[model samples]
Target: MVEFAALTYGLLASVILSAAQRNSKMARPHPPLLLYLGYLLCGLSAGAALGLGYIILTRFIGH
Candidate 1:
């Protein structure tokens, strides 16, 4: 199960990325669905990374 920190990080990153995409004038963000999909992918990745980093820190580095 994902922890609170991971969820928080994912949500924060998603919000930031979405806002950045909106404020940008590039045509790369033409499709809104793509941006939402990107957010989903990013949140999943960030959550996974945070979870793994936490595990490594607590198990090996003695967090």
Candidate 2:
């Protein structure tokens, strides 16, 4: 379950980041490597945070 949630959130984050980049007014000819790394880091962090939260919630609810 945790793996599933993390994978889902990570993919979601990537999709959203890509969409935002596409819609930005100041579109760059090519995105910087740092920017791509930042997106990956953001998605990983978001997924980790959510997974932790889910674990805590399940424990709290005695599931």
The whole-model lDDT of each prediction reads 0.73, 0.75
What's the true lDDT of residue 16 in model 1? 65
- lDDT tens digits by residue: candidate 1, 1-63: 559876886777777667667757564444676567667777778987999899998999884
Best by TM-score: 1
Off by over 4 Å in 2: 1-31
Clashing pairs in 1: none
- In model 2, pairs of residues that clash are none
- Can you tell me which runs of candidate 1 are displaced by over 4 Å? 1-29
TM-score of each: 0.49, 0.47
TM-score of 1: 0.49
Candidates in order: C-alpha RMSD to true structure:
8.6, 8.9
lDDT of 2: 0.75
